[model samples]
Target: MSLGKSRLWGVVARGMAMGAADVVPGVSGGTIAFITGIYQELLDSISRVGPHALTVLRRHGPLVAWQYINGSFLLSLFTGILISVVSLARLIGYLLDTYPVVVWGFFFGLVLASVIPILRRVPRWNTGAVIYLILGVLVAIGVSELRPAQVPATPLTLFLSGGLAICAMILPGISGSFILLMIGIYPHVLTAVHELQLVKLLSFAAGAVTGLMLFSRLLSWLMHHYVARTLAFLGGILLGSLKIIWPWKLPSDEVAAMGDKMAPLMSNTSPWTFAEVTGESSYLLAAGAAALMAVLIVLAVDFWGHRRGAHH
Candidate 1:
């Protein structure tokens, strides 16, 4: 295939993967983008909608700003993500509700397998990289351990939460919706979006646009100047995030009643060891492992192909 065709296919594959990830709560599309080696490009593309874009908008109008933005790239990538999210949301939600262990286990494997591709990209390992990795891991572990907070479920709050959550959504190891959950906004924002609350939805969209544009620039700058270290840190974040994504559990006793609607609240208590070992559900773990292995194999093939192309 021509280089352009090859790149096009690669982007399409990435979009699909990203969409799949976005459908999962703890997993992140950013992780898929990072693992697939298009993270920097995505960040750069987002960052391009910057001050200059605002200036163009002010001078010429929204059309000018749209022209300045990489609309094609954004449209293609986001369309894929949107399709995946919308199509899979109900299915993923059902799986998480009905077969929580299996779904989470699968994600655990996927994230674990992702580490290999991420770490392999670092041409050199050093003290700084090691420290960054450790730091990232620690942060993830800490974040995972944090108890979810309680906050108001209001339109403005949902808007802000949407913005912040989407920003984290784009980071390789961070889960945007998870962040919303932490802030007690996940349910509210999701409800607003689902209910077709136009005001809330538009507000949330504005916030997401602002957050994506701003955060992308910062990310792009870091990737440009501190490429290796940033990736190392990101790898650590991914490692840390696994705790949250890990499938398997003991039931939580804590239940919060939200206006007669009872919701199970996860506690700090650890899962049962027995459940992890001997259970009919043990098959799920094996399946998860297989899925992870498949991801690794696909990544390896892509890497090999890219290397061969470079050599030729």
Candidate 2:
């Protein structure tokens, strides 16, 4: 519960990584949390932030309640998330726009490499665990295949979108931004962030808080009782999500007609096919390098985390 200065900064850095991942539609901040070894702690902290914390506040004091809920960790993590989200939103958008293959390649490699560490954490793989893992993969692929729906961007819709998206955002394979995009609110949310639309952002934040409070408890319980199965399922999700972030994509005719270059319809292809179909260079070498770099980064982080855990 105590966050020393060095540890606080470490948590902040992890949060920033999560935030950056969440900005991209196919990447989950939760994936970053898992790879960085904070997934369980993050869930437990969020799950503790309600009635008990209130009771503790009234009976003990603000400080006791804060400690009970791991307030410092949450604060440090969220501060990093906010900072990264605000600063990287535009930049990430630009990169995805201008260099789609390279950007997607990097995240693709990140999620792919992340699956190894996650699956390793599963102590044993039973029949039920395998089934759950397969189910997770199927569900993620199904979600990825969904086309964006048309929805009005009213406050109510934004609130609902936030609630749904936040749940996905915390899951290792599911992406909150992808959820928003599916609901047809991604552009609205991104525009609000970019333009600093306070009212809209606050509405979204309120929904996210409510959803996080409710979902975290259930996820935490599942994780506790079904550790191996839960991890397997999440690992499956990461595997399933690889299809969504594939570097070579052929834009859907509808998306091209809409003039929305960035919001592709998740049509995948090989680099050769992409180049042949679009007559644009697939940038295969560059994309491959990016993916390779991401894989190395994830492996390094995983190794470092294990070493640190051993020390602890």
Candidate 3:
């Protein structure tokens, strides 16, 4: 394919992968972007909607702001994520209920598999990187243990939450919805989305746009000026999040209602211990292992292809 065509397909694939990840709670689309070698570009694209965007909007008009929006990239990626979330929400919810173990097992495998590429990306193995990795792992474990809370779902709060959560969504090792959950806003935000509440959605979108622009610029700066340390830090965060994303577990004592759905408020137990030995556990483990292996293989192939192109 031509370069343009190849790039087009690449974006499309990325969108689809991101959408798929967003459909799952623990997994992140940002991780997928990183593994696919588009992390920096993705960040840069978001950063493009910087202060200059607002400046243009004020000096010129909405059209100028529109111009600043990197429509192609944002549309492709977000469309993918939106499609996945909308289409798979019920399916994923069902799976999580009926076959929770297997689903989580697969996610565990994915996170485990991701460590390889993240580690390989480090230009050098050093004490700093090791420390960062450990720190990241610890943070992820800590976040996993946090309890979910309920918050009033007002416009302002929803807007702010959306902004922050969306920023997290774009960053590997961060889960936007999980962040929402932490802020006691996940249920409301999700409810708004499910009900197609345009006002709430738009408010949230505004926050997301603002946050993405500001955060992306900061991320780009860090990546350009402190590539190793930044990536190392992100790698560590990804590692830490493994605890959050690990599949398999006991039911929570706390639950919250969002319309008809009853969601778990916190994880009071770990996935390793089970009440009993069952075929479900075995099936989930195998499935999780398989999914993780698949991601690893795909990443390896992409890396090899990149290397070949560079050589030629």
Best by lDDT: 2
lDDT of 1 by residue, 16-74 (tens): 78988887767889988876667877898788877887888899997657756765666
- Per-candidate RMSD vs. true structure? 3.8, 2.3, 3.9
Instruction: Please list the residue runs of candidate 3 whose C-alpha ends up more than 4 Å from where it truly belongs after superposition.
Output: 1-3, 51-71, 86-94, 256-272, 275-285
lDDT of 3 by residue, 206-254 (tens): 8988887788889899889877767787888888887686554555777
Clashes of each: 0, 0, 6
lDDT of each: 0.74, 0.90, 0.73
lDDT of 1 at 172: 79
lDDT of model 1, residue 184: 72
The order by descending lDDT is 2, 1, 3
What range of 10 consecutive residues in model 2 has the weakest lDDT sum?
Answer: 255-264
Worst 10 residues of 3 by lDDT: 275-284
Name the TM-score of candidate 3.
0.82
